[model samples]
Target: MPKAFPDRASTGWHSHRRAQLLFSLTGAMAVDTTDRRWLIPPRRALWVPPGLPHSVTMRGRVDMRTLYVEPGSGVDLPSSCVALEITPLAQELIIRATEAPLLYEEHSIDGLVMRLLLAEVARLPTLPLWLPLPRRAALAQLCEALLTAPDIGAAAAPLAQSLGISERSFARWFISETGLTFGQWKQRACVLAALDRLSAGAAVARVALDLGYDSPSAFTAMFRKTLGISPRELGRAKPRTPIVAHG
Candidate 1:
């Protein structure tokens, strides 16, 4: 059955045996690893590699379908957590799998469903909006401030000053800690905040304003460049391929 988690936070640890596919059917959620975080909206799922430490945070009412695949079932998936685009067929498989019994008899429909589902798992598109927070005390504080006010558009110089370090020193510290450039991490933060707001049903124009975009068109253009699709197409996708086989 589908589970709806409202205002919940994960233990933020790794699991031993299961690779999880967490899809949001309603509302929005964010998943964070020690190094990176992803914001997941409806029609999107996050594939978490087994034994990788991570945490899930709910932004609002979250309806999620979580699939715990056997260790080797999702071999084509990445070793790290990634936000994926959910096709209609994949969406149906997850919902059906969740509704089916855990154990299947030999030659059962459930077994076939599981097999087909595994094949489709490799086709999901992993987006690149990873929020990498630096671990240094001062830099981490800087990240926290930006996250707390996602619309804040302060440049690196000001941030460096606030951290009481030369801009070059702060840049080196950020690179050492997060493996992302100052500009790259900032862009990701803005996109993630935009995703969160849009998933909550905010209009694109309004989301642009909230994220400090000069205009909605500019924000949409950037989003398309980063994700290769419009934000409006995220959760409302139709099936590109039909399910041809079922047991």
Candidate 2:
């Protein structure tokens, strides 16, 4: 389905039986899954596996194109939520797919178009937009605390002790559950939290100091490395609305 959402509008938390490919045709979106959250820009699409709880929040006035794939349509997308990089070919096909009728004839040109879109989507590369959390309650709680009071400067030793585990075990759990070491996950958490503020129109310098970055330039460098664009441009860039081919 194709829908336009006002800035910051959200779908709240919901799930469905069919897998979904949510492509942002304009503006940006934040897709929150059970343990991970993804900041999906126009350059990316988010794949949600069947029955996975998710919520979508628009970053600006957003034109969202969503395709619900049948539970078993032969597409081998990731069972977990992922941010897929949108190739130019896949981008065009997505627009076509979004505009096509939901129950269009399977043997017609629309059918072929949708099949090709799925094929392209399946093979598309992924973006590193997902921020995963620990599944363990204690570690998850620590991560939440760290994200909230980022200035705590608490080391893993203290956190591990508080959790009644050895530092070695805590490190292993952190890496295994979140796919990031304690320090790496902390940095990622700070960056992602900064992104939430930045998208909501916070100034760059203020976010930088708040997140413990020594200077705005340091934060900008990290943002550039992660997002491939300066955070300042996030507000100024117009959402890219795909030109759907009309029947």
Output the number of the TM-score-best candidate.
1
C-alpha local distance difference test of each model: 0.79, 0.81
* Top candidate, metric lDDT: 2
Cα deviation of 229, candidate 1, in Å: 1.7
The worst-scoring run of ten residues by lDDT in candidate 1 lies at: 7-16
TM-score of each: 0.89, 0.76
Local accuracy of candidate 2 as per-residue lDDT tens digits, 183-202 = 87776777666766776668
lDDT (10s digit) by residue, model 1, range 1-247: 4788776545466564778888878877888887777788777888887787787888778888888877765346666677887778988898888888877764798988777777787877777857877777878887988887776366889888987889999889888998888877777888888888887778888888888889888888888888888878654656656567666
Candidate 2, run of 10 with poorest lDDT: 237-246
TM-score, structure 1 vs. true: 0.89
Candidate 2 backbone clash number: 0
